[model samples]
Target: MPGKVVCRDEWLAARKELLDKEKAAVRAAAAFKEQLRNDFPMVKLDKAYTFEDPKGKYTLAGLFQGRKQLIVYHFMLGPDDEAGCSGCSFLTDNLPSSLTHLYAADTTFVLVSRAPVAKIEQYKKRMGWDFPWYSSFGTEFNWDFNVSLDKDVKSPVVYNYKEMEKPFKGELPGLSVFYKEGNDLFHTYSTYARGLDGLLVTNQLLDLTPLGRQDVPWKRHDEYDSKDLKAN
Candidate 1:
């Protein structure tokens, strides 16, 4: 149903009331984000995890790329999968192309998946994405981060800090932040589920519309049908 139509004065009064709540919500969000930066506990990483790119192999520290911090998106592309996850692709679709700002802030952003370098490169080419993507094949990095689940390898599956029944095979999406100090790397923070909503610019835009995302099914950017592309 459409919203009830009202006079300009009444509409302005209602909008102003909402504006006050929006301002309060923004302030609360800022305070929580500040807490994440300063109060979150850090875990020192001792494992010598390795990943591969189109060029060659690189260690965890190498991913920092002279930056003091690294942001890794645990892309849900398993070894047997032919393509990336729709949700992960949606998130990447909204990522900024130029990282000069992140670089200036001493942070490097990259994506990691269990797919091999060849597969990663192929899909990246198809999607026309230029972001750095690394293959975590033959590494326990996915398991360690709880993004890839295996019934045999790990008991009592846990994801997003909740216990789940052991499934034969599964891959989930998540983001992890690491801080580098000299040669030491620390796992600063990680988020999953709705914690990632803030990163999707499309959803933010839709929220301002009458339909508000509509729980729409995600499609790889290039896969949207002509009918779906048409304006409603």
Candidate 2:
């Protein structure tokens, strides 16, 4: 079925009427969600999980970089994989420019992956991204956060607040937020799978188009072909 075609005036009137309801619903839902997020109880973190960066090793606390809040993108780049996941790369490609704004709001953003620092750095360079990235290569950080699965494990793996009967062998994507109060650190929130959709600017923008997302498959920003690049 095709959409109804109407004159400019009629379309304008209908759009305006829909906009009124849309605005009210959006505002109400946003306010309720904001209150729920703000009121969410935080768990105190006492584990001393260490991560490796190009410069040196840092504990979870050091990843905050003196900021009161920290946001870590759990990038799905396993140690044995040749490259990072295309979806994860797309997310990070949109992150560099937002770093300064997040910093101003007292938050530090970083990418964490199970891949070695060298592999992560190489991929970061290939993508031409300058954001901070760290490796949890030999640490329990990824497992603790439920983003990694052991290859030899026979049981189901838990992800996104549920157990998967068959899980991916390696890394998965997620986002975890933490807060620092003096010397104490707390886990404020963590989201996985579709929960990370809020960070995807491309999807958000495409939603405004007449064709919506066009059922297109996502590629890493650097991997798009000439035709796709030109179209974009």
Candidate 3:
């Protein structure tokens, strides 16, 4: 739908009003982030969880790579699936090409999946993703994190810190944050479902437009055809 036509003076007045609200929203978000950093509780991780990547195995603390903080995006690529989730791929596409800024801030970003290292390598090569990716296969990392669901692993599945209404057998997308203090590792935060909306740059940009995202289904970057490239 087209927006209402307005005189330049009227448009300016409306824009100014919206700008005030936008500034207020920004301030509110900053306050919430302050609480996340200063007030949130951290859970000490004692279990020995192992993960494998192209370079071999790594423990949860090993993922920190000498950094004080770690951000892990749980990519939904199960052992039986041939590809990763489209929604997860969408968010991965928005990740920074260089990690220099995060590294400078004593933080590292990585992706974890339930598929084997060999499978992860194949898909990572196909997607041309350079971020550190590891496989939690043969381990309870995914189950413990509440991203992967398997009746055999544990019963009465929970996600977003609540019991799932329906039985699910696959992987779900989520982001988990960890803090490393010397030899100890702590899970500081985790967000699932729509809580991850802030990570998608495209969605954030589209939200500023009148049409917003239009409930469009996301596809992998390579999967978009010529028509999609042209946006026909």
Candidate 4:
């Protein structure tokens, strides 16, 4: 047998109290997000490693200039030959609304990739994206986030996909952050593996579509949708 229950308002009030006081837990989770931000593991981009773009020459740290916090999305783009990944493109589609909020809060968001600046810019134009995109090609930039991928970003042109067609490997989608303090810049967080899971807003929304993310399932993906719960 279970204990007697309280009135609805009492239950709601109790839950709200815990929800409001969860900052310590939130801060602990943020510590995981701030892993790279505090240590600043992102190395400074070298002149030799510089890339030519329609916007002109730029480096890694230069991307976060004049901003308090930098939130970078590791967009899935490889080299010139691969075009781009549709899955990542879908993720990028979910960014604008959030970008507006981040701007209101004074945070900067940009998309980083292993593709050339020219390639990235071209895709942005094609997709009509307004968010800033940068190239991490020809440097340790991609590997730093665990997505630019080793064999492709490193040097080898073969052994991954085509025997001799495509040259470089593509980057997996991810999100990273950085902070600036006067003249110093710190790499705050870099999410890979499941850290990129939060960007799956598109997948979540799709589950609400007529067919849902899974075609065979008879009902909605309640499990995934339940991730976004509020106090009853």
Computed on alpha carbons, the lDDT of every model, listed in order, comes to 0.93, 0.88, 0.92, 0.64
Tens digits of per-residue lDDT for model 4, 160-193: 2323354545456677777767666666566664
lDDT tens digits, residue span 1-232, model 3? 6599899999999999999999999999999999999998999999999998877889989899999999999999999998888999999999888999999999999999999998899999999999999999999999899999876656788899998888877899999999999899999999999999999999999998999999988899998878877753
Ranking by lDDT: 1, 3, 2, 4
TM-score of each: 0.96, 0.92, 0.96, 0.60
lDDT digits (tens) for residues 1-232 of candidate 2: 3368899999999999989998998999899789757777899999889899889999999999999999999999999999999989888866657588899999999999999999999998998888899999888899988899775772567889888867567778999999999999999889999998878888888977777888788898777789886653
**Candidate 1 vs 4: which has more TM-score:** 1
Higher lDDT: candidate 1 or 2? 1
Q: Per-candidate RMSD vs. true structure?
A: 1.5, 2.0, 1.5, 9.2
Candidate 2: residue 202 Cα off by (Å): 1.0
Instruction: List model 1 lDDT by residue over 181-207, tens digit each.
Output: 988999999999898899999999999
